[model samples]
Target chain A: MSARPQVDPRGPRFAAWVTSAVLVAVLLTGWWPLLAAQVVVFAVGAFASLSAAPYSVLYRVLVAPRLGPTDEREDVAPLRFAQGVGFAFALVGTLGYAFGVPALGVVATAFALAAAFLNAAFGLCLGCETYLLLHRLPGSTRTVSDH
Target chain B: MTGALVALGTLLVAAVVGFALRARDGRVRAREDDTAARVPAEVRAALDAGARVTLVQLSTTFCAPCRQTRVLLSDLAARTDGLAHADVDLTDRPELAKALSVLRTPTTLAVDSRGVELLRVGGVPKRENLLAALAPHLPG
Candidate 1:
């Protein structure tokens, strides 16, 4: 396949910080609506282009301009796959909260928080890492790499 | 009171992760044990002929830092005589990751002439540290 189109690598990490902040809010309050909103955010970000996601838009408008030019572009596929992993956890967590399964909701939200935290703090994309693991899993939902 | 406690707990979590990762970022973890640090035959042979050092970078498709690491190592390899870089795609090669005891993407190993692993960097490597690590093996 032709080379994957490049995007500023910092964009995803910027978005992750925002996601982590929102997740921290969700965890502390145990707020269902906020949880559901985050689930939708992850779903849209994963399935649609990152620009369609809210925090990403903020990054594009506010963060990109302030930062100087970058040659550190990256493939979009992995970012999309990572978003999907985030979406899955978000979906499960939202559902658990909606269905009164507080334990599941708490655990899933905590897990997602941990992943986001890693990306933001350590530049460690647990979602990106898991994409490979998911592909190898027996019943994984990874999108086949078009490349 | 409960809300305050939850906020405190979240902050604690973030702080812990920040501290732990700070300790690892760009730090070189040496593998001086001769027998244990020996490179796999396949990996050793993959090194460029006559090269003294091989920077074998194990990366996955989705890892953003892997791209940066690739460019960094490639540039270093090109500039230095007898220095080679191998970017291994671990997406389909989990076995290799296991073989090298890799814990994450962008993990880079510096293999020397004798097929001994000199050092392994777990995250984005500091160029100064990497250069220092290779100084003994690289010819001026």
Candidate 2:
């Protein structure tokens, strides 16, 4: 079996950033339906992250085997962080819904969708990139490198 | 119904997002000119020896779909007789990627024993497709 290539971590990072931003926006906007939408989106993203390996396996069998080996530890950390943040955002949206925030969730959900769009469109992956960049900084670098 | 609608909407959004990304960044086109001659003489010999099926998967690291495909093919190879699956990583070999015209991760190719191409699948192939593809070659 040949070794797989290294894919840029940008995509997942961007996804994380989008998820975070959307959650924040929904909290402020008070759009219940939209907020609900964002929550589902975040969950799907989380699920995708969790079930990543199986999907990769499927790709290898059906598609081209030109894939690179990934740094799983590096990849999983951002995904977990995103998942946590997304869940929190969902909780907030639910509360806002109960309190009659009146479309605050919807607006926030739109923002999240926008963020997701940005990540996918521009390959911005800001969250992951930020983590990686910060991780490379002095103390963090040492910790990551050591591990 | 609401949940299903939400799921469909999300998929549509994802598709549009993916398409926009592709448009902005341009699709990664595999170069078809550089065929790797790295197939060892022994491997070629094995391929020539009535192996009948060559499963070539093109994949990249960090691609979730690629890994899933690999497991499926391995399982299939193990369960089936006389069908051989060779996973070729395209990351290190741009030449092979080009030669095979691989555009996306996890492109699978079904080849004959002599290395002649039979059918090609650009994404994760369904089990039914694989079974149907192999039916003609399977021992009756």
Best by DockQ: 1
User: What C-alpha lDDT, on a 0 to 100 scale, does residue B29 get in candidate 2?
Assistant: 26
Standalone chain B TM-score for every prediction: 0.86, 0.65
What would you estimate as the lDDT of candidate 2?
0.50
Runs of candidate 1 exceeding 4 Å displacement: A61-71, A129-147, B1-4, B36-38
Clashing pairs in 1: none
Give lDDT tens digits, candidate 1, residues A29-89.
Answer: 8887998898888877777777688888888899999999887677876777777778788
How well does each candidate reproduce the native contacts, as fnat?
0.33, 0.01
Cα RMSD of all models vs. native, in order, equals 3.2, 14.1
Q: Count clashing residue pairs per candidate.
A: 0, 60
- Chain A only: give the TM-score of model 1: 0.90
Model 1 DockQ, alpha carbons vs. true complex: 0.32
DockQ of 2: 0.02
Interface RMSD for model 2 amounts to 10.5
For candidate 1, give the lDDT of residue A60: 89
